[model samples]
Target chain A: MNGKYRFLLAALPLAVVIGLSGFFYDRLGKDPGELPSVLIGKPVPEFTLPGLEDGAPGLASADLRSGTVTIVNVFASWCAPCRIEHPMLTALAKVPKIRLVGIAYKDKIEATRAFLGELGNPYALIGADVTGRVAIDWGVYGVPETYLVSPGGEIVWKHVGPLDETVIRGELLPRAEKLLK
Target chain B: MKFLLRLSSPRRRPGPFAGRVPLSARDPGLRRDDARGWRALALATVLFLSAVPALAIGVDEPMADPAMEAKARDIARGLRCLVCQNQSIEDSNAPLAADLRHIVRERLAAGEDEAAIQKYLVDRYGEWVLMRPPFEPATYALWFGPAALLLTGVGVILWRRRHPATVPEAEALTAEERARLDRLLKDEDPA
Candidate 1:
């Protein structure tokens, strides 16, 4: 009995060390800022908001269900990262069969128009979410979040920050092409 | 040793005309003055620290009714600030948190109860918006895991105490070893 208890006591530290090491190992190579979206693989939440441009029809959830993959970008004129990613978004607009829609989050229409005028508008349709209500529906934490919605209206992928050239070329394009296939 | 040395040292006279005064008589006021200064400094430090959160983060304008304002504060405290993950909406100065606080106040003013307001937020941001997760199947482990671990630890300790380990039987000594042990014991015995 003494020997058995001693053996068990000896195994306890080894078990604890292994458990802690496994936990840390799992954390390694993972970005702490990359929070998993709870809405992944789920249908896009319903929302309808006014358009940013004059007389343009506002975007609705039904508009995204047009049997084509849509890239929905949530941005604001005041957000610095949105400005950085605007050019990349412009480049993305040139890609054939890619439907890019922009949601102007919590920004004035005039400011958004000015921002687009200076930066060059890449969005096919721009929706003004003045109250940020539409953004909340999409589970947007902050500005410059991008979502890839499937043709069937499911939110396929979500990127939290500014999309650089590398990310656009490496991740977005590949994922978009995969959805197209 | 340092205190003893100081105690043994002779006091220095203030002037040629004056006799040596005891250290306590001369320095008691100085010590009291130093202590008073420190106490004032500490009080100021505490006050500054306590005032920082209020000054740093400008909360939204309070409702006219004190009870309504308190309810808004309670609701805000329970909501998480998406921009600042660790801070509640009540504590965060982030623009998004400010917007959420405004929404909460608006909802409360509209006579919407706390549950309905929280549900509105949860429908948008999912349950992650709640600072305290609701009691649900998904969160059962998170809520009960620590207590379960504690109980398991106590049970293991109690079991170990109740079923104490017994020493293993020892091997019998050989005749030669027994004779040597007897001789050594006899040699050491004064009686």
Candidate 2:
């Protein structure tokens, strides 16, 4: 073979091997994007957070009643995926059987209020988790995490990431309905 | 697309240019000129586009969207921490790393484009901030060396398989080897 062709032949296998390794490395290193709940089947963390809506009295663990299925959503004004998932939260609010509440994780009141105002508040009671201690207790790695709390205050399921219409309709509602029954 | 591909592709030149400049008397003026030219280019690029100050402007003020904060964290996790090698900004606790994380959040809340945000960070911290170093002459080995090594290894294995080493089954034993074996066995004998 000529010099250039020989060089090309030598380079081709090297390129192929590298491309294959990179493809596998990317595939193997990728985060599965599913955050498994450490709080599953455990009691919901006890917290007293200031309410976002009426600015009324704060919400506490005692507020959760038995026999009702509630979705406690952790959100912040700074989370974009929360915005993506807001419509789903709003739709879930209209479902009478499911009580949807929002926890404003480590965010200021003004920002939280503006965010809700623009997105349309779907939460029955929005709690300000100012210090993020409550969020940490709930094992929240990031915002837009939702937990399904049984009437008995037992956290039955958690869905990490944004709650889209598909997630709410498919994963949350079906599981909640089962809990309610 | 071609620009992006170029940015992502690793380029290696194993020619004479790849070696470091030897500080010898040979072509001293020319080598000095080359080094100076590269230094000037790096400095000019750093100075012209550095938007480091823009990171601090909007953070002190309260944001209108708290949700963007979470998005910022997600983006930061994807971003490599400039000051700390091989660590994502979200996972790093260094003061500059923290500042970078806060800046990313602030910028995201202010509605910065992802590419622009990445570029802004790169301009401030240089290409080192990027976890996946852009394919360039300097980073060619980091990106493509392993594959080259693997190919070479496979080639060696194939060559070894095609040209197996010959061995003598019986005549291989030398006189000295036979004497040593006999001595070893005699020492260990029960009799």
How is the predicted docking of candidate 1 categorized under the CAPRI scheme? medium
lDDT by residue (tens digit), candidate 1, A51-71: 976788878899799998899
Clashes per model (N, Cα, C within 3 A): 0, 13
Error of 1 at A172 (Å): 4.3
- Judge candidate 2 at residue B169 and give its lDDT: 81
Worst 10-residue lDDT window for candidate 2 chain B reads: B5-14
In order, what DockQ does each candidate have? 0.49, 0.03
Q: What does candidate 2 score in Cα RMSD to the true structure?
A: 19.3
lDDT of 1 by residue, B1-191 (tens): 22332333334324453337654466565445445556666898999998986763375788899899889989999998888888999988888888898889999999999999999888767788899998999999999999999999999899989988678699999999999888888897745
Candidate number with greatest DockQ: 1
Supply candidate 1's per-residue lDDT for A36: 72
